[model samples]
Target chain A: MITLFGVGCLVFLVVCALVVARTRDLLAATVVFAAYSLVMALVWQQLQSPDVAITEAALGAGITSLLFLLAIGRTRRTEDEEG
Target chain B: MRHVPALLLLLMVAYVLFLTMAEAPAFGVVDVPSRNLVVDRYLDPDPEETGVPNAVARIIFDYRAHDTLGEATVLFVAVGAAAAVLVGRPGPFATRPVTGTDDPILRTVARLVIPFVQVYAVYVITHGHVSPGGGFAGGTILGGSFVLYLFVFGPGRAARKLSPARGEMVEGLTALWYILVGLGGLLLGASFLANAAAGFPLGVPGKLLSGGAIWLIGLGIGLKVAATVANLFLHLAGES
Candidate 1:
């Protein structure tokens, strides 16, 4: 059962990574990246590393996401199209 | 196509990484080389040796405290570099406060949630020795609350609560406190950051005060990290 859950988490993580990579809108990618961090935190917890899970949730998902949002607020929201 | 060679290179790198992963230790296996005697030495010695039930905390705060100190120094230097870069760079919104969101619901929710978030951060820091959290996790949460406040209420009000000068003072003081705690071990005829081996009181395990210098060092790190993180956000947001 736990293995199934871990597999699900891993799948979700891969999906998030792919979405973040494909998204050209900086804001959308940041949000997807935050989701990736949150799911990664759950994976850490499943691996019995709650210390890492807590840090990942707080720093990875929360703080980094906020930082990205703030940076986005300052800069352009979309990636520039290549010539 | 222009991208064909790039794709082939990517596939080649991926195959190499896959081979490397196959050669690595299996997931969660007990007989893995990573699960060496070091793990046993960290866990087998009861709380008497380390003064904490949480083996993670014991390892970080007691056994390998010097590394943690280095980590703290790195955080301090990173924040300093950020402050150096951001401060006095006259962007239009650099000095003054960026007006906060005027949304009533967001403001109301922030008012309601900030206190709980801060309280939980304190809990994570204080209870680090007994639980899964430690200074880093808790300190980030604490800074996160301040960041949320800055988001909802604007830098003007947030700075009034914790001005940049005050934040610098707190950061420096907490860092000095960590060094002082480490020096205590040396003063008491032991190596730097030594806990029970330094002849300090370990107290009863499972208690809040059980870990001798571990709890103290954790507290210092918590405050220092909190200050550093908050200051970083404030600087990056053009307030500091």
Candidate 2:
């Protein structure tokens, strides 16, 4: 049962990663990347490794996403050059 | 054309990972190699030998202290590099206003929440021997609180309490403190980072002061992590 859930999560995350890679809007990508990190944290939690799960949730999801969001906030939202 | 090798490399890496996972002990297995050796000793650790109850914290702070020290050093260097890279910019470092920050909701929320978060960080660091919390987790939380403070209160107020300079100093001192604790072991004719044998008192188990050098090391690590991460934020976020 847990294996099924784990497989489902991995599949979802791979798709999320691909979407983030393909997305042109840098801000949207950053937000999606944060969500990806959060789900990854959830996977760790499901594995019963609370130590690793907490670290991932705090650092990966919380701080990393915020940093990316802040950086994107200060820069262009999209990759397109406006002439 | 160029994508083929990258694709092939990805497949190769995936195969290696798959094989490794396949060989791993089945989840929830009680008879795994990991649960075989040294697990019993840690489970029933002699209080006279070591006061710490939690095997996770005890192992890291006692058996594998050098690794933790190395990790702390790495974090220090990483934060230092980030600060140097970000703060090297003259305009961002200088002209950014250091004060007069007031977003009403953020300010109120941060003011209400930061103290509790900081208290929890301290609790996690100190209670490591009895719980899932430890130096790394606690320190991260401590640093995170400061980051939250920076976002709401701005650099000026945060700097007043813990500037990048102060952070560097704390990290340096804590790193040195870990070394000093290691040296204490040598002083007692024991190996570096020696726990009870280093003459550190092993009080009765479950007490706040019971873990001897483990708790001390955790304290040092917690302070260093907090400082390093907060300093990292100050540097990266316009250093106001």
Q: Give every collision pair in model 1.
A: none
Model 1 chain B weakest lDDT span, ten residues long: B90-99
Residue B63 Cα positional deviation in candidate 2, in Å, after optimal superposition: 0.4
lDDT of 2 by residue, A25-73 (tens): 8888887887888888779888766667666766787678767755664
Model 1: how far residue A37 lies from native, Å: 1.2
Tens-place lDDT digits, model 2, residues B1-240: 989999999999999999999999988888888895577776666655578877778878887888988888899889877876777675533443334357798888888999999999899888877777788888888999998888777777778879788889999999999999989988988889998888888787888888888989989998988888788877766763
Candidate 1: where are CA atoms >4 Å away? Answer: B91-97
**Residues B1-240 of candidate 1: C-alpha lDDT, one tens digit per residue:** 999999999999999999999999877678987787888889865777877999999999999999999999999899888888788877644534456899999999999999999999999999999999999999999999999999999887888989888998999999899899999999999999888989888888899887999999999888988898889888877785
lDDT of each: 0.89, 0.81
DockQ of 2: 0.36
How far residue A3's Cα lies from its native spot in candidate 1, in Å, is 2.5
